[model samples]
Target: MSDGIDDAKRALRAELRERRQLLSDQARTTAEEGVHRQLDALLARTDVRSISCFLSTPTEPGTRSFVNAAIERGIRVLLPVTRIDGLLDWTVATPDGDVTDGLFGLPEPVGELLGPIAVNDVDLLVIPAAAVDHRGMRLGWGRGYFDKTLGSMERCPPVYAVIYDSELIDEVPRDVHDQPVSGVVTPTQTIVLSPQRH
Candidate 1:
């Protein structure tokens, strides 16, 4: 990554973090509800039997309701379990299961890991992103966890980034290793991005 692009990304991440933190309680609830409705409708049309998803933190676009609903529909939902080496392990999450505290303030699953390559078992992947551009470029939290995971997959599924509507912009600063997603899901809509080659 060039120093200029790296600097811009740092600034953008900070700005987005502040925006999330400033959301009011009422606004947050409304957004979560909206996301739930949109996501539920999106899932109804897909034949995905298994999914790889992250357990959202408070400020992120909500996924808890979707996860529970998927499980209820007999879909297998795998949640990421962060490892000491910065790679993520997969674990099956049940609606009633407990989420214990994990690294970087993340809530993690309670079972033995299915290992990093376990992600390949999923039919679809819904990942976290600070911002995703119209060109499908995803700007993640500085750590290269998701990028590395996506890069290592031998036969990757369609990966979608979950973000607020406003976070889907014209462009975001990118590094050589930055991974692009196939689509983006916001509170109001699911956008299918055109394919981009590295």
Candidate 2:
């Protein structure tokens, strides 16, 4: 049974990877615009003091607009920095500043590592996922980065996994280490789930 489940997950991941790669430039732009609009709405509803988000990559759903908007709102913006111990550390970033490339070529803020902030200090956490289920289970890029990071947090923040609308699924294969999200923000809508169930 386990083997069959693993096989199914592998196949699904491959198919989704292909689809992500085939996204046309125009489609990518439209998706990004939609994400920005949703994020704007979220920001307006919440009195977020600080946010932790990622820098965008071509294949990954981008968060540049969200980060910029946070900066413009005078909200403290934090980005993840890869530690030598293979852990993700949070650091503050400016609107127009340089960032350094880290694991998997992900860009991170170029500044003093504020180290791990109190998870409660982060009002919102923008998570990156390849796909997410209606139950809020996230299928990451299989790096286990976010899983490990969240596990280490003293008090986990409200996590919002960002994805394209089409990437939302009814269910997903999950392991013991997989952490569920509090909500999911898609290009089309925001689906809130019960708190994280590890």
Candidate 3:
């Protein structure tokens, strides 16, 4: 059973990667606007005081607009930094700041390392994913970064995945170590999963 699940996951990931690569510049721009609108609505609905998100890379969904909006609202924003042990460390983000290259070429906050905060302290976690399902299962980039980080937390915050609307599907293959998400924000909609499962 586990082997079958693993194979399905691998196949789905490959498909998602191919689809992501096919996105044209015009499509990407349109998708970005849609994502921004959905995210703004989600933010308005919640009373969250602080958020932890990532710095975007070219291949990843860009987060500049979301980060800027959070900063403008005076919401404390945190970005993930990779630890030497292949884990993630959270630090607050600064306006127009520089970041050093971290694991998998992801950027990390460079100035004044704020150490790390307990995961429970974060009100919302904006997670990146290759794809996510309506049931809250997320398929990551296969590095196990967020999985390990989420597993290590004693008390977890609400995890919200950001993806293109087309990437949201009926289901995703899961593993024992996989952590379910609380919600997902796509270009078209904000999907809130049932709280009982997570």
lDDT of 3 at 11: 96
In model 3, which range of ten residues has the least summed lDDT? 111-120
Assess each prediction's global lDDT (C-alpha) against the native: 0.88, 0.79, 0.79
Put down candidate 3 lDDT per residue, 144-191, tens digits, no spaces: 788888777777888988888788888888887788788888777789
List TM-score per model, in order.
Answer: 0.96, 0.91, 0.90
Model number with the top TM-score: 1
Candidate 3 stretches with Cα past 4 Å from truth are: 195-198
A best-first ranking of the candidates according to their lDDT comes to 1, 2, 3
Shift in Å, residue 95, candidate 3: 1.6
Residues 1-198 of candidate 2: C-alpha lDDT, one tens digit per residue: 277767767787898889989988888787777777887788788878888888877766667877888798898888888776767887787887687778667777788777765344788888888888888888887767888888777877789888888888888888888888888887788888874575
Q: Which tens-of-lDDT digit does each residue in 1-198 have in candidate 1? A: 899999999999999999999988887787778777776776776788898888889999888888888899998999999888989999998886788998877778788789999999898899999999999999998988999999889999989899998999889998888888999999888999984858
Lowest summed lDDT over 10 consecutive residues: which window, candidate 2? 112-121
Candidate order by TM-score, decreasing, is 1, 2, 3
Give lDDT: candidate 2, residue 42: 82
* Segments in model 1 whose C-alpha atoms lie over 4 Å from true places: none
TM-score of 2: 0.91
Question: Which candidate, 1 or 3, would have the higher TM-score against the true structure?
Answer: 1
